[model samples]
Each structure stands twice: as structure tokens, then as C-alpha cells.
Target: MRVLVIGTSGYVGSAVAQRLSAAGHQVVALIRPDRGKRARRYEWRIGDLTDPDSLTAAVTGDIDAVIHAGTPTGDATVDATAVAALTSRLRGTGRTFVYTSGVWVLGATGTATADENSPVNPIPIVGCRPDIESQVLDFAGVGIRTAVIRPGIVHGHGGGIPALLVDLARKHGAPVVVANASVRWPMVHVDDLAALFGVVIEQAPAGTIWHGVSENAVPVRELAIAAGQAAGVGGEPQVWPLSQAQAELGASFADALALDQSVSGHAARDRLGWRTEHPDAVPDLREGSYR
Candidate 1:
């Protein structure tokens, strides 16, 4: 299968590209040709989003599936334009089109573990994801195999979100919140999340929604302590209140930190048969990779 994966350079993309390659799939990673020194399995192409013609060469000929892993920045129009253009270019091709969405879209789920079928309550940063997903999923009805992968806090070697917690734990002089941390959040290793992509490309039906997560819900404060221990700051885990955490980390972060966003991945595991090799998020923190 000739698989075309966009943005195969970053943390999640790198891991996913590697896994797809190792699994014996022919991968063509849309990359800047200038990055010749970096090791990768896919063919690099120089293309601009504004000029769809540039990507015509990349998308044309014989391409089986397109995994849109490219992440856009602050501008909504730019991201929407890229999605629109790419969708237009690949329409009616009967190829798999996978989009990467995040768990933040589910927002605060209180204590109950929600699934792919659960309602989405997005945060400020990713609020537009659902609308974008709607456009992609619409293609499924047109003979295109469209799907979305919603991942949780994707922690891995290069210091992602877990690093933020470890930093807060190590730098904060005040007592951290370790009791009644009430927020429930889901987590997954980068590799485990990458495995889900293969599942989507090969097995998922068109318009399918998958939770690219392993553990659905873990207490917020407990996750912080695990981060503290991993950051080499273990001393009878401090039990600070939400107000206290707010005072130390600021209210915006405090609010986000306090979110109990737990969602179930039973659907993904049942369908993809994914097993997380690095199940513990805190241990990844202690390895100091977060540093």
C-alpha cells in the first residue's frame, strides 16, 4: 500500500511514520526536501499549501491513503484552507484519509469515562477540531475512507505535556495538589497512539471515530504526584487545594490543570487491539526526558 503521510517530522508524526514503515507499508512522508540529513522511511516532497498544484504531483499518480498529520498554527483560515484544499484534491479517490484530533476536544467529563460516542466539549485552542472533522468525515459517504483519531495527553521522549507537569512539580515551592485532585484525564504513550493510526488506515470503516487513548481515567492529583516522583521531587506528596494550585501555577493553568477529562478507549482497544508498552505516565517523567 502506498501511504502518504503529511508532517512526518514532529514527535507523534516521527513515531507514527516509523511504525508504519516498520510494519512493511510503503510510506511517502510529505516533507521539505531540504531536510535531507534527517533519517526517515518516506519520500520527501517540496509542496506549498497555497499552491495546490505543488501537491498535485505528490497526490497524483498512485497514492492509496493520505494520513493528514500536519498541524497548523494560530490562524484558523490557514488550517481550514489546507484541509479544504487537500480534501478537494483527494476527493472521490476511494483512499483512506485520517485526521489527528486530541482529547482536549472532549473537555471536562467530570468523573464518568466517556467514549468516542460521547459529546465533545472543546477548549479554546482546539474548539475548531469538530467542524474540521465534520468536513473530513463527510468524505466517507463519497467512497473515501475517512476517520478521526482523538488522542489524550501524548507523552513521549521529547518532553511533551508531561514535561509541563514535571516542571510545575520541580519548580513550585508551595505544596502541590495531591488530594481530591478530582479531575479525571486520559493518557497514552506516543508509540501506543501511533499504533492506532495503522488500525485506522487498515481496519476502520469510513466516518469512524476512535479514541487513541489507553487509560481512560486517572485522578488529577495522583497524576501530579507521579509527575513529582518522576521529576525526582518525592517528599510525602504535598496536598494543596485547587486555590493553592491556582496561586502557584496561575488561574488559567490551574483551571486547565484541574480539569477531570477522562474518556474511555475501550472502543479503540477492542477494534485496534492496541497494547500500551509504556502504560505509566509518571515513570516517563522521572526518566528526566521531561527535563
Candidate 2:
């Protein structure tokens, strides 16, 4: 398969690129010219989706699958515009287009071990989700294999939000966790998430919605303590109201930190034969090592 990965140089895209290439697929990474020289064995195409010509060049035929991982900033409408352009061009091509959405779109609901069918709680940022997923899924209706992957808080090695928190812990000497870290956030390993992307593109039903999560949910406080331990920082988590978290970390990031979102990965496992290698998300944080 000739896979053209949009935004293929970032964290998740890079991981997915490695996964597909290791599986014996030829990978074409569509990256910004700024990523400098390309890595070995992979083909590189310099382009930005903001420009139609560049985007077309990125996805021109001979591309068998597309991992739509690029998220343009500045406007929600612009994000939709980017997705619409790619889906419009790729419709009926029999190519698989994988769209990455976050589990945050399910919003805040008491954990019922929600799966792909959970009701969505709309945050301002995630409001674009339904529209975006709908557009991609519509491609399946037009004969393209379109799949949407709703990823949880992914962590592994230098990736994951927890590791990023470790960076913050190192800088601030102690991390301030919102509401005592008990707010459940779903999480997965970066490689596991990338593997699920491979599964979806290859096996998921055309209109299926997949989840890239391993554990059902881990408490935020537990996650915080682990990050602190990994960073060799020590301090009891500072409990604060949601308002305080918003004030401390910008409100958008605060919503993520404070959201008690638990999502189920059962559907992906059952339907796509996607199994997560890492069953636990806290061991690395708990012991200060990802090994």
C-alpha cells in the first residue's frame, strides 16, 4: 500500500508512519518544509494543506490510504475546510481515510465505561467533532473507506499528557493537579494508539468509529502522582476548584485536565482485532520509567 500521511512528522503521525512502514507498506510523509531533511527509507513530500495545490500534491492518486492527522489552528471552520477538501478529493477512490478525533467529544458523563456509542458532551473545541466525523463517514457512503478514531489521553515515553506534566513538574518543582487528580481521564500508549490506526485503516468497517484507548480510565490524581514520581518531584497534589484550574492553566487545557472522561476500547478490539500491548498507563508514572 502507498500510504500518504498528512502531518506525518508530529507525535502521533510519526508513530503511525513507523507502524505502517514496519508492516511493509510504502510510506509517504507529507510534512512542512521546516522539518528539515527527511528520515531514511520513507518518502517525503513538502506541503501544507492550507494551500490547495500543496494538499492535492500530498494526496494525489497512487496513495492507497491517508491518515488525516493535520489540525490547522486559527479557526474551527478552517479545520472543517481542511477535512472537507481532502474528503471531497478522495471520495470514491476506495482509499482508506483515517480521521483522528479525541474521546473528549463524548463530553463529561459519569463513567459507564462508555464505548464508541457514548453520548457526546460538547466543549467549545470539540463542537467541530460531529461535523468533522460526519464529513469523513460520508465518504464511506461515496465508496471510500472512512474511519474515525477517537483517541484518549495518549502517553508513552516522551509522548502523552502525563509526560508533559512531568516536564511541568520538573520546571515548577511541584505539579498543581486540578481537583485532586481523581477526575477520571481515559489514556493509551502512543504505540498502541498508532497500532489501532493501522487496524482501522486495514480492517475497520467503512463507517465505523474506533477508539484508541487501552485502559478504561485512570484517576487524574493517580496520574499526577506518577508524573511527580517520575520527575523526582514531591508534593501532595494541590486541590483547587475548576475555576482555579482554569486560572492556573488556560481554560481550554483546564477542561482537559479536569474532565472526568472514561471511554471503552472494547469495540475496536472486537471489531478491528486491535489489542493494546500496554494494559497499564500508570506504571511509567509510578516508577519514573516507561520501561
Candidate 3:
């Protein structure tokens, strides 16, 4: 399959592009014209998610599938328009269209673990995602093999949110946990999430939704301690007041970090045999990647 992947230079998309290429799919990276060339492993197409004409131009010519792992342009209308532009070209072609979403859509799952079947209560950071997800899934009815993957807080490869924790530890002389110590996060390694993308792009039925999580819930305090270890500041993590964190990281993003969620990815594992390689993120935070 000739797969056109957006956001190929990003942490998640880079890993996804590599996995797809390793799986013998011809990977075409849709990059913004300003970003110039990327790794030669992918065939590059000049495009931008905010530009419909660029997106339309990039989706043409023997492309078998599209995986949109790009960062949102922060405008709901633009994001929806981009999806329309991409899927419109693939309509009636039966080509795959995978949209990247996040677990935050199933907000604050407290005790009961949320799954793919759970109702969405999105936080402000991703308030518009559910609607865009619906737009993408609706394409399945028009002969496009459209699917949505909602990944958990991504960590690994010395990057992502965990790295931010390490950076915070270094900056403050202690690791920081937003809100309270009980906040938990669902997580997935970048590579593992990428492999799931490979599987979904090839085998998932139209309109399917997959949760790309591995660890159902990891306590943020535990992660902070590990991050402290990585930062050479081995001590108890400091709990930042929500107000303080909100002042720094903004309310929506800080609230998202403080949210407690236990999200299950068992659907992908049970149905698609999408096993995760890096199940435990603690070691990755302490001595593996972030270290």
C-alpha cells in the first residue's frame, strides 16, 4: 500500500511512518512547504493541513491510504475543512483515512475505565475533536475506509510529555505533578502507537475506532518521581497547585494534565492483535529514554 502520512516529522508520525515503511508500505510524507525535506526514507509531498488546496494536491495520484497524525491547526473549522479536503479526494475510492485523536475526549474517567465504547466528555483542549471524529467516521459511508485512533498521553524516545516532566524537574529542582498526586494518565509508547496505526490502516473495517493506549492508568506522582530520577533530582515530586499550573500552562492544558483517566486499549489488542512492546513507562522515564 502506498500510504500518505501527514505530520511525518512529528514524534508520533515519524514513528508511524517508519513502522509503515518497515511493514513494506510505500510511505509518502505530506510536509508543509516551509518545512522543506525530511528523511529520505519517505517519498515527500508538499502540503499543509491548514491549506485545503495543498492537502488536495498531496492526496492524489495512486495514494492507497492516508494517516492524519498532524497537530491540529487550533481552529476547529480549519481542521474540519482539512479533513473534508483529504477525504473528499478519497471518496468512493475505498482508500483508508485514519484520523488521530486523543484520550482526553473521554474526560476525567475517575474510577471506571473508559474504552472505545465510552461516551465522550471532552475537555476544553480537545472540545472540538469529537465533532471532527464524527466527520471522519462519516466518510466510511461514502466508500472511504475511515477510522479514528484516540491515543493516550504519548511518551518515549526521550520525547513527549514525560520529557516535559524531566524538564520541569530540572528547572525547579524537583519533579512537578499538576493538581494532586492521584491524577492518573493513560500512556502509550510512540513506537507501539505507530504500529497500531499500521495495523488500522491496513486491516480495520470502515468507521472503526481504536484506543491506542497500553497502560490503562499510571499515577502522575509515580511518573514525577521517575522524572525526578531522570533529572538527577532524586526526591519526592512537588505538587503544583492547579491555579499555579494553570497560570503557567494555561487552564485547558493544565486541566488536561491533572485529569484522572483509566482508558483501555483492549479493543485494539483483542480484535487486531495489536500488542504493545513498551508496556511499562516508568523505566522509560527513569533510566531509558528521558534519562
- Candidate 2 weakest lDDT stretch, 10 residues: 282-291
**lDDT (Cα, tens digit) per residue for candidate 3, span 5-102:** 99888999999999998999999988888876756667899988878998998888599999999999989999999999988889998989999999
- Relative to the true structure, candidate 3 has a C-alpha RMSD (angstroms) of 1.2
TM-score of each: 0.85, 0.92, 0.97
> What is the TM-score of candidate 1?
0.85
- What would the per-residue lDDT of candidate 1 be over residues 1-291, giving only the tens digit for each residue? 778887787778888888898888888888755556476556766665455555556775477888877775545676666666666656777788888888887888875778888888877667688888788888888778899988887787845667676776777742255325555668888888888898789888889899877777766566677677766676544666778776866765566655677788889778767667765665565554563
> Among all windows of ten consecutive residues in candidate 1, which has the lowest summed lDDT?
173-182
lDDT of each: 0.73, 0.77, 0.92
lDDT of 2 by residue, 161-273 (tens): 77767776676677557754678888888889889988887788898898888887888777776777778887876565778767867788777777787788888888778
Q: How many residue pairs clash (N, CA or C atoms closer than 3 angstroms) in each of the candidate models, in the order given? A: 4, 3, 0
Better of 1 and 2 by TM-score: 2
TM-score of 3: 0.97
